[model samples]
Target chain A: MDYGWLMFCILLASWLGVELIAKIPSQLHTPLMSGTNAISGITLIGALVALAHTHEPLTEFLGYLGVFFSIINVFGGYWVTDRMLKMFNNKNNRK
Target chain B: MNTDIFYVISSILLIHGIKLLGKTATARKGNFISAFGMALAVAATLWQHPPQNILLTLTVALTGAYIGLLMAIKVQMTAMPEMVALFNGFGGMASVAVAIIEGIKLNYIPAIYYDTLIYFSLFTICLTLVVGGITFSGSLVAYGKLSRKLPTSSINFRGQEWVDVILFVLLLLSAYMWIFTHSVWSFYMLIALSFVGGCVFVLHIGGGDMPVIISLLNSLSGVAACAAGLILFNKVLIVAGCLVGTSGLILTLIMCKAMNRPVKKVLLGGFASISKNKQKSTRGTYKPISTEDAYYILEAAQTVAIVPGYGLAVAQAQHAVKDLAQKLTDNGADVFYAIHPVAGRMPGHMNILLAEADVDYDQMTELEPSNARFGNTDVAIVVGANDVVNPAAVENPDSPLYGMPILEVFNAKTVFVLKRGQGTGFSGLENELFFKDNVRMIYGDAKATLTQLSAEFKE
Candidate 1:
């Protein structure tokens, strides 16, 4: 299997995903983006695998970057999500 | 330079950050934990051989940082959800890009060890692309509806469900084919179908359920990243993705449970529609009060508790309500805010809105604590809120929200409700409290009515 072919498939899928999401209206973007961020946060798994396998200096370096970004994606994503969820708490005791 | 030291530091930051998020009082500290963790991770990465392409890395990091900072500073609390969706989309996009780069590089490695690694990378890349794409598009649509750029009702096109199902099946089939046959076309089709499925799924869902849907999508994105991380054999991505996915699933479930509905029911899109039917009721006989008369009563009251709702959000009356509360306090009246757990469109909506008005947090109490004292309250002021205070929840066993806890504002000595009209609440139920003998309907915009009440209190 040619590496370029695999890479093309990955790139194509990613571009499509981003473009489709971008086309959604602005109002839904937060939850939608938050959901996708959770998906992106899954990159943590990739970072872990990279850590386990990589011995080469270049591979180790990329693995480190992956780990850092993945952590940010997970932490920042959940924080924003929690904040958004808090927006629904209303204090109106009308009954 | 021990790599173990970096890992230990990062792990500690993550743990501390999570702890900070556990308590309401330490929420700000939680934000700091997140910042600290990211900084530590970045420092560790930089220390592991300075970036060869310093300009590229710095440029991307700076660009993302700038945009994020701008949004944090400029975005109103109301628009926070949409901003979250955008950021999530960016994260998924990033993962997909990384997976692709890794897939390309895998070709350069020897074919003997290629089967496992290349296949895993391919699978992850495709999964991330499809799921990420769908989440991105769906979130935008949700944002539009929430911001009123589009209507909040279900957009039911003919055969919408059938189309979505077909697309979903096709997406699965494509994934299957890609794994079995290793065909590029299968991968492309899978991506296309998944993207289309995302759009269709979100479009069919009504605005009321966007929060749950968004949370679910967030989980999906997390799983996608987890898969990618596994493909790349990156420990951090794996851990981070798993944590996010688990947390997201839990949050989504909690949101659904709070509504007292099943996840399937929420996803199916009929709840809000059923609510629409209940909105229309035979007109009941009830005396309404003018803003002036209500203001007079409020002015004479010794204790006032303000209950806010979606109406306040619509009227943008948080500031006015705060002002009213202050005036009541100044006039020797005890004032408190009673917050129901699920009052606004989402959880904690009222707190954020009121906080923006500089309302003292100490004066605000959760429903459980305040309800115990409602009978002693001289006047319970309800501003643009409904449902959560509905007496039907207590008396009607068949009621959708029956057995659900509510703020007993009706138990107060006098209840003054400020509303524009007798509109149904988010749950689509007519509030019996509106017609209670002790209740007075003060009709108008929340802000204006509160202003009137505040002026009278001052006099």
Candidate 2:
């Protein structure tokens, strides 16, 4: 896609984001934040591309750091969110 | 399926995943769907564009994933705010790494190619670097505050606002230099300035106002990612980043609204100074309640409202609180939790802490409704909470916390405040509720007080 097209997508997605997040209740705000944190780790793809296309020492090091950070962000964010969400279930049977 | 089509599918999953997260029944499934989408996106990227040095990439990625999962497992429920802040810092730094990698790649292209590309690459590269740096450092500051590594007080000095302005102006000038002359030093300067700018911006906000700053920084992290996506023209990154950016902004706005602060002032460190505004306008002194007397009073109360704050989690009293609530329930008292929007360090913090103790979400109530019901409540049992239940926020006009929404615990027939000592809250605002005639302060560690109160009920 061209630069202009990418900008358009960014704008559209932002509009989508506002609409998507506005409906969430205040009680679920924490999980919503954590869940989106994981989604931002989609930058892992960008990092992978950097590592794949470069052979320079600086690029390799930076690319590796990017991969590492994004990977943890993805796994940690999602898992932590899941763990938190697991606690929110209604357990009427509990004595 | 076309490899390109996989990106489309994953994007759909992400959008739908967030949509589901708003609902309690579907929230867990939403997390699962989002993770599944992320996995699919990663797999598609790996399959379509296999890395040249797969060994090194896998090693780093796997190691990161292991650490992330381990933290997710090991982190205490009460420490969720700090963990989330730390993760946000890593995500922010990741964007910086992505931007730097792209910037290096751009340096390889001929100078004429920069003009042909509309100077767009330079702008996105520079923007990504500054914003990413800001998010990383700002998030780290947030982490420090949440974890108590740094004092939770806002560190304000003379000319702090001027310093922020100067840094920002210099940052813009460097960005211009980087874009026009492609100077390497200008690029590095941008990085340094943004990181400093972030720390300075966040450092100026008061500890009580940290939840707002953290939310705003979380938004910045997403914007940085979006800029990185713009540099690479990646669809999935753009969608995910944009989604996170807007959502974080909305969350920040919601927090500001909840606290009755404007977005501009919150960012400008409007509430930074640790104000010592302790006005005792109410009649009568704070009367301490013995656990035995508290139990007698509680046992006879038919309706109870429990107002909890960050201190509840700090004292790890959630389980004790639940036990007391159960005891109250069995004693023919209807017990419910009253949650203030900005109750804990992060949004919904108290909910997570209480949920960890198996408290059903149904048992919890939000501010306005709980406020409306407190007038009818026989007793408002405030546990380890100060600022949120402070009557001064609404009663006294001169207070720093004035106009901020609070739990009107004084409206109840009897108010039992579980606190540690005579000190003020995080904002240093002396609780006006404590001095009210109906209010009885129970000074001690919250968990011990709750357990003892529960034991009294058992007798």
Candidate 3:
């Protein structure tokens, strides 16, 4: 894996993230924050790989914790974001 | 077939999802899209590289899912800020665990596999651990403040800036030592000190600055994930983490701009002295108004604006507030909610609470429009809001909150401030709006007070 290529991906993604998120209405900022927070749990991939193909007790335990916590973040963050967005959406429909 | 294609698909979904998340009509769908993207990323990883201790991974994953679902379903709306902070903390700890495990494998795994790993992987390892450590600890402290387990004020002392600088320098030294010498002991120090650094970092900022800290820590967690992605050589983590990192950073900047504060000032400049020394900057008399009398005044008003603050959320009065707003609308008052960008404990918290209470989304307004309409408004009902409606933000330059935008509630023909006591707001600064001739104080729990006002209208 070339360091330069990894840097390239990161830079491009960052620019796109900013462009995508710009001009959001203030009412949706909380949902936006929680949504992006859920996306941060993409680290679950790293955690999954770390846990896989391993049998060493101590390292395995560490990876196990990683898997547990990232899953919680991924699931919890998305569910919370969904609930909030639902509140906003429901209110719009009634009007 | 290159399995990396899964990562590519996941990244595309995330980018598209975030774009839709920004708009009003498509936010829910966007959230679903991103969640699906996350599921794909997780499935691809598990299918491609299966965990050897299958039972252990499955057990851990199931428990996490149950707890996550429970938390989402069970949390009260008032506690949403704390819930978000807790989730951020957990996300950060997950990153830390991932980085630590990677470091452990790098240290003990066979030298042949390590040979293929670049030396820079060590740097990313340290980066992930340190940033994740800071995010985890800082977010926990934030959660404590939001939950009222810790004092919401800045715990500042003399020369707080010097302490921060010295502690930061120590963290840098430990990271540099760990990277250069590849010593596990230095690695431990880096991890330990960053956690300490995190606590010290958040403790000196006032609670009013939470919107800034939460967004900033949110950004830090993303950067941590990016570093972890580098360690695992996972493109999905890199793209997703980098996207969250940058977007969170942008949100942080927006929150700071709304408060009219520089990022460096909120991050490092101690706020205790600023808030402490500026107490009692202005003084004026206030009038108390009974809800019974207020109902009469409201019956004749043609236009009204409701400015909600953190106190409204604390009292869980959104439902009662909605009732009152509906009653006012029945009386021919054109009522709308004025939302300050930095309101409640987090961004858009009041709006969520109001929406939860069934308030029409169309009736809510943002700062600039609300401010502009206050002059034409017949009545401005401030529900347990003080600092946000404070004229001190505009007129009293000596006040600590000077130069920050406010609801300009005083611009209305008649103003009513519902307060619990005569003391200044949580920021501990005097509110000029309370002293205005047009303003009257209604003292009680905001929910009870609003309920009474609505009952008065019901008659």
Candidate 4:
């Protein structure tokens, strides 16, 4: 795989995603930040891949820790965002 | 099986979910949809690469999830900012761990080095460690301040900017050595310096700048995750990381615009020095009002707007504020909250505070609309908020708050400020609104004063 092309794509996509975020109103910034923090938790996939490649004892230990921390970020982030978003009173939830 | 199909599907869902979050009505559903996407991605990954010790992996994942759930359930609304900060820290630390693991593997398993790929992989790994470590420690410091475990005031020293530059250069040097020499010691050194750099980077930013700091660290974590994905050649990870990183960067920029400062000025060192002229002379004294008198004014008012700030958090006055709003509503008075972009130390702090109080969501207004309403408002109640409503933001160009948009509460027919004393706000600038002829200051604890005012409505 050509690393240069892949990195360029990642940078471009990320820039576009941020442009989307800029369109959101400031009132929604808190939830958006929290929501995106949850999105960053996608690193759990990386940790899983690391664990799968575990060969040596030290490598295995690092992989385990990676998975552990990423799990916390992922599960914790989503749940917390859900909790916060639930409080956003709007017309749909007013009743 | 390529399993790439699952990656595509998950990425689409994640994007859709994030897009949905732009509106209040759909935000909650968006959160759930994103979570589902996350789960799908994780499940697919685990399915593709089933670990030899399934039990051990399961145990670790479950334990982590359980802890996260408990914390999310237990934390109060006011602590949400710090909780978000800590979560970002966790994400950064996780990426750092994964990057290190991948780096070790890359070094040990002499893989086919295609032109520049080896160099790119090594560079990304180093970048991940530096950025991830910084995000982790910086978020911790932010959490400490938000939670009152550490000083909320930005701690600055002589030659602080130079110190930061020196640390950053040293960090780059260490990372370079680790990459070229493959020396484990240099790698450890890089990690240590990265952590320290993160702390120093944020240490001098005052409490008022926390929302920006939090958002920036959130983005840094995203950058770290993306770098880790690059090192590991994980497409999904790379996509997700970019989404998060860019969004966070935009949020930081938004915050910087709200503060009327350049992003570079904020990152180099923030409003710590804005208060250096603390001995600035006061222009006029403020008039104090009793609760009964304030209530009478509020009662006679046809429209009222409440502006809350970090002071409300300190006084835990959100509930009382809500009750007061309800009473005003009961009296046939129009009531709404004016929320500044940077209000309450965190984004949407005022909204969540009011939400927790079960206030009608429609009653909350942003700065622009709220300012428009202020001209028609009969009474503007400043509740433990100072800087956001300070008229100096517009009237005095020399003021630090100048050019920053404010609530325009000073335009109201009558303004009543609820405070404990004649203290300046978090930014250390005295509010010109306080000394205005039409304004009245009600001195007391915010919660207690608000409770008293609410009782006056009952009378």
Candidate 5:
């Protein structure tokens, strides 16, 4: 079983899934994006797997780079998303 | 077994995070849950092969973390959509870079299957690169325009449509060469052509269509990511990218529907010119009112509902509005703010600006909830809002905003409109609400007029 073939299947499936979700109306987009961001969090798994496979110097270097950037994207994306939501909280409790 | 457990837990967290995003109340928690999941996934992956060279990895991680922190702390809420576009663009760019690097690395490889993969990768790479590059540069321009760092007016040159067509043809030709000849130089040329095409497309669009444009760019970014995901053989990337791409396209279509415009018409340009011509033809049909007369009516109204728009945003008059509301409240008149869903420059624009001025959130009601209350109100004070309150939406079938729900402020006992002049809104459509017998226009800067009205209320 070729991992490359498996990868292609996954890509096609994902693309189809995304297209299906995209067909939803405009009003649903913000919520959908919020949902998808969480889905993208799964990329961390790939980063980890990529890191684990490489004891070699170049693979290790790329793996580390992937690890570092993935962390920022994951954590930072979530943090900012949280703050943006707070803006809509409507907590009129301001004295 | 341990890795399997981590995967299960991470996947659950991701699902939970998405659930949280469903309601406005739980959106923050949803984001945190997802973030935590991502962090867990990263940790589990890294721990599986703990960087043998730990120092370099740690340094790189810390530096990236610091810059991200700075952006989070400093970037304004109004700029959120632009930032989202920027990040999506970066993701797309990253995918293109990865595909390019992979192609170069395998340039000398011996596998026929790898050659096919290279061809597919190159095609996706160019598609994503062109789209992503345009989205990136175009979004930056949008940010600048929204922030007032760049002019918001449409930058139309003579025969611009012809130029755009030529560029599109060139881009298509270059894409063909890259696909068939496998020429790297053609790929670079395609990149340049796409970037220029993006700039021209965005420049032709007016401020009114920004939300639609942002959503479109978002879709492009998603497609780019999916393409990149293919090159990397990553299931998560493929799934996530496709979701984003498809969602974006759907959103763009919805936005087009909302504006009563076709997606093809929007993409082809010249909307601003048509709108401008419409405005010119409709000018001078109604008599304009003075500030003093407008203030007299405002002074006497028993209940007033204030509707703010992009004009109020331009004047930064939220504080003045808050002051006016307080004065109205003190004068024994009931006052509330009517906020349209897509008002101001972005979603929740009026609410955010009003919040900055310390306006109580409870006093602000969304369009649907507030529209019902407007008819009973004695006066509707329209501050810089145009199309959202336009009577044309309710009455005219040929009107640009026909069939779309509006604030129905025209039904109030008296309608007091404060505007800079008789200038049209971002949509470039004439607001028939301005010409209504019950409506009176107060011409001046919204900030100045509101301040005067506040003073009169105090007196």
Candidate 6:
């Protein structure tokens, strides 16, 4: 598969995603932003691969740092988004 | 090859998860679905690649997750913006590390590589370095401001703008030198300059514009990740990166609309802090109304609209506001909440607060819908909201917020503004709505005032 074609498809898909997101109510915007932030943590895959492929000390150090930061981004973004969303109680649950 | 099929499935799930997040009732499920997809993607990647230092990888990941979880759970709702900033910074830094690794690896490849591929790889590394560096340090500055560790006001020194331009140009120069000379020194210099450029880029932005800056940084982090994916030829990374980047860009646009400014103006910087000098003008006098008077007027109104702002968030008055709205509804008044895109510090900040109070998603109206109904509304309550409802956005061309889109609350037959004091809003701009004949100020803490007003409606 050609890399250029893949890049084009990704760009198109992303545009569609944004169109869908724009339709969401303003109430969920914060959670949506944070949720996407969590998704951006997909760099974890690249980091792990870099670590596995590289044998040099300098590359290894960079790889470990990448893995560490990627984990923080993924976990923190999702958990905080979940906690915030939890606060949004349904009206039926109201006292 | 086996992992490609799994990656495709993972990408589909990610897209599905984001789509489900559009509505209120399904948002939590959507969040979990996205996490599930992320887990699957990570597992597939590791399973296929099988890193050499597995123990170290797992150890770092576990430790990072533990610390991240603790921070997420312990942070207060008021500090959410900073929490988001920290996560974004982490994402950016991760990309930076990945880019450096890829850049080093590229050097080991034989010079026989396809010309386009080599150039593309170099360009991607440069982009990842600059964008990721900016996102990381800028987000840190934003976190500092939000947490009050750094000055909330913009910090500028003489000739700072020129310094910023020079730093940016130097960053580009270093990237160019590294590409042509393949010098490790030039690469490290590029990294250092980018980090400094990132900090200087955001330090001058005041707290008021932090929300917009945060969103922009989020987008940059995504771009950085995408560049990293390009370097690795990882399909899933590319897909996820593009999704986040586009979404963040759209969000940034919405925020600019809320502020009634162009993207260029925001990027050039200093619009938010510039408003500080225009603080208080001896505009028209405001009419103050007691709670009793406010209650009397509210009881007779056939329709009511509530406009909320950051002040409402500061006072934690969403619950009380909900109670008042319920009271108004029970009395046979049509109650609707007018939500401006930038009503709170961040996009949907007010909506999140309202949702926490269990306000039905249906009753919350947007700027356009509420504005259309304002003329028919018998009473409009401005709960600790100033800038959004300010008539100055429309009527006063000379005002800082003159062109911003504001809630047309003045069109209502009667208006009551619940505020703490006579001070200007977060933007430090005077609201001309306060002086209009139809507007009345119910000066007090938002929660207390709403509580008192709700009590008057009790049988």
Judged by DockQ cut-offs, the docking class of candidate 4 is medium
What is model 1's interface RMSD?
A: 10.3
- Which lDDT tens digits does candidate 3 get at residues B154-262? 7887787788889888888888876666567887888898899889888876877888888988888899899899888889898898998999999999999998889
Docking class of 5: acceptable
How do all the candidates rank in terms of TM-score, highest first? 3, 2, 4, 6, 5, 1
The estimated TM-scores of all candidates read 0.77, 0.96, 0.97, 0.96, 0.79, 0.91
Candidate 2 displacement at residue B130 in angstroms: 1.6
**For residues B331-365, what per-residue lDDT tens digits would candidate 1 score against the true structure?**
78899999775555544567667766767667778
Which residue segments of model 4 deviate by more than 4 Å?
Answer: A89-91, B106-115
TM-score of chain B of 3: 0.96
Best by DockQ: 3
Listed models, DockQ each: 0.10, 0.81, 0.85, 0.76, 0.27, 0.71
State the fnat of candidate 5 relative to the true structure: 0.27
lDDT-superior candidate, 2 or 4:
2
Stretches of candidate 2 above 4 Å error? A90-95, B108-112, B116-118, B274-284
How large is the i-RMS for each model, in angstroms? Answer: 10.3, 1.0, 0.9, 1.3, 4.6, 1.4
**Lowest-lDDT window of 10 residues in candidate 6 chain B?**
B270-279
Which candidate leads the pack in TM-score? 3
- Compared with the real two-chain complex, what DockQ does model 1 have? 0.10
Q: What do the candidate models score in CA lDDT, each in turn?
A: 0.62, 0.85, 0.86, 0.84, 0.64, 0.84
- List, residue by residue over B313-340, the lDDT tens digit for candidate 5: 7787889999999987887888999877
Which residue pairs of candidate 5 clash?
A18-B242, A18-B243, A22-B246, A22-B247
Candidate 1's displacement at residue B391, Å, is: 3.8
